[model samples]
Target: MALRLKDQLVGQVVDGRYEVLSRIAAGGMATVYLAADARLGRQVALKVMHPHLAADEVFVDRFAREARSAARLSHPGVVGVYDQGAEGGTVYLAMEHVPGRTLRDVLTERGALTAGEALAVVTAMLDALASAHRSDLVHRDVKPENILVGLDGRLRVADFGLARAASASTTAASVLIGTVAYLAPELVTQGRADARADVYAVGVVLFELLTGSLPFTGDVPAQVAYAHV
Candidate 1:
């Protein structure tokens, strides 16, 4: 992407180890890249925080939470993180790289999944969340895009970047930490989330998998959030 120019990562090495190959995806806080581990001689997914977020002191804790959360999990249903550190303006987390499509991509291509198909997809997701919950981590975002359905047919729930890494629900100054459409009611009103909140999000994902649409629609974001509430 054009943004990569501003990020002197792709085609260059970082920390004298990972050789950022190409940009994979971009999100609100970070841009993910496919990279080669020069020492290990293997491929890994590298998530580098946006220059703004990396430079902002406000997001440091949240960024570290993602690194710790993913690094702690070794479940088959969840992607494993290998390393995390910052170099100059780049704060990056290197993790497992999976080749595949996301649940959202599946829904877009197939128009919706049958009951059986949807169940299989969500069950894998649930197992991953169950692992996270048992580890005292609550994934704040559990949307379809964060769930990867690998080309080898494995389901991997990802992006533990924003979370309640503590066992208790957290109150954040930000209005929300997850996708507004899948946010639970309590999260909307109180800005706190527990394991049940993750379950609720998965349930919504299941519904969307079946219908190929979100339950609530709106002309603007506020209206959709109101519908969710």
Candidate 2:
């Protein structure tokens, strides 16, 4: 077998504060790592932006917005943001380290959930989104991948990276911000998203949790997005 390469950030200290422990996962925009905060002596989930993305002003602004948006809300159902900073070219957000799998993982492993379990998960997600709505924030993206289930059976909504102020207007012409399957129709057609869009996504998630499959599927993301429209 070919040898696996080591992650460069695994042992590096970020901003002279967060000591990167190990990579948790990598997404299109960033890589999440289990990290140690030297000052507070605690563990945190460090979401570091990809170097290429960091170089783009738009992505950098979005990264900063995530820190600002999540920091404004104080809800147990939502993941907490501890800090955000950059060292050299590395920009990162230090957030609460939720020790468990994502809702997506659960769905993949268990197929479907019982009614009680589905209700519990959806309730937690709604509560978290309600908190964001009250703060004038729209999550913009709500999917199973963004829902983290703690080992203690607690569910938290995470990844406010796509969130924007409710007053902000969006157009379909702009870059798409959410997953296709869970996207609200308005979001797919006109690109407008508010609390209602989040609610719509939650409904889709609830359906998937109980049915073990998305209501719509297609060979391409555009086809799935078109279905939402």
Candidate 3:
């Protein structure tokens, strides 16, 4: 079943530029594929938005805006954005394909890290966040899943889908962004977030790295979020 699903778009071309090679990963918003850029003659991670989401004008606009914002950040610790567009109802973002495992995968396998190792990882993540903050962007979601640990011992933060301009009014009572385990108290209580919220999440990640367990956990997401308050 999984193999059949993986072969679905194996040979398809997106935007007449990126030729899909294989499936890399799939998340709630999109499926990522290893693709060959016919124009540049290089490899890229093609993030294709799910059809249901591509059908939403608001989501597509926001996705494009994220590409622009992330592209503006030129930092070693952040994944690079190459291009974004929609072709035949297929909205996609072409990004630098970093060959690595996510921090989440490491934690899941190793259970925890030494204090020195944890500090090193967190420092790299902070450096990336610092660059984003300087660009007036706040990475509202700062969980392990968004952090990539390269084979060369470098760390790069990815997925700015939940990021927004720090100056933008980040108050949404109707919507909650970010993982519940790493959410800040202000985010849980007021539905407000800023650069400080990112910092708070970083602290939570630090704790998890050191202890191999989240500071807060509950049977349901609401319960976990409430504990942050």
Candidate 4:
């Protein structure tokens, strides 16, 4: 295994094609790196699965399947997955490097967005979700953090089919995955998630973008789960 960098992912080549330049973001399942594709001579966002997740065969299989599914979806509002591969025990995905702040960053800095801006962002997200749903793909995670607002004022959805895919085969009897405050009531209570579950999450995201806060808050997962009721 390569040494993990604390601040940046520099001086690392993924799959002998993408050279890591800097750390873009980190999530529960993967760490995203802004990398330069040596073969194509272009910038791309490389999402490498966390070491812990790589240890699970189910997660690895689901990650690859989701990457393949996401690659088939192309839209102005959906971030494109270009390639996926495993090299040196590292599984990485090559995606379009969207240049802009995340909706989470925007909301954090601006507090609350104007109605028009919020609607615009929601519309873009819904458009992307619609496209995915049309193709029988369900984006189980939809939140401000996963929504990127590009330099052109366009909103693009990222990490499509990732959370759902990773957690699909895992026993949902005890584990409560997903961001707490944004989880749909059905997902929390019934462990049933479909397109409507995504719609519910989208509604929650819009609620936060408009009110500058989550509709529910709790100290623990159980407390949060109760709030969903």
**Number of the top candidate by TM-score?**
4
Evaluate model 2: give its TM-score: 0.90
Tens-digit lDDT track for model 2 on 96-136? 99999999999999999999999989999999999989988
Q: Which ten residues in a row have the lowest lDDT in candidate 1?
A: 165-174
Model 3 worst lDDT run, 10 consecutive residues: 165-174
TM-score, predicted candidate 1 vs. hidden true structure? 0.89
The per-prediction tally of clashing pairs is 0, 0, 0, 0
TM per candidate? 0.89, 0.90, 0.89, 0.91
Q: Cα RMSDs of all predictions?
A: 3.3, 3.8, 3.5, 2.6
Which pairs clash (backbone N, Cα, C closer than 3 Å) in model 2? none
Best by lDDT: 4
Candidate structures ordered by lDDT, highest first: 4, 3, 2, 1
lDDT of each: 0.78, 0.80, 0.80, 0.81
Candidate 1 Cα errors over 4 Å, as ranges: 5-7, 163-178
| Residue-pair clash count for candidate 3 | 0
Model 3 regions lying over 4 Å from their true place? 1-7, 163-178
Candidate 3 C-alpha lDDT tens digits along 1-229: 3244357668988888889999988765568899999999999998876666676676667767877988898999998999999997788888889998999999999988999999999999899999989888888878998898888979999977543421132232212333678888987787677789888999999999999999999887889999988
Displacement of residue 78 (Cα, Å) in model 3 is 0.3
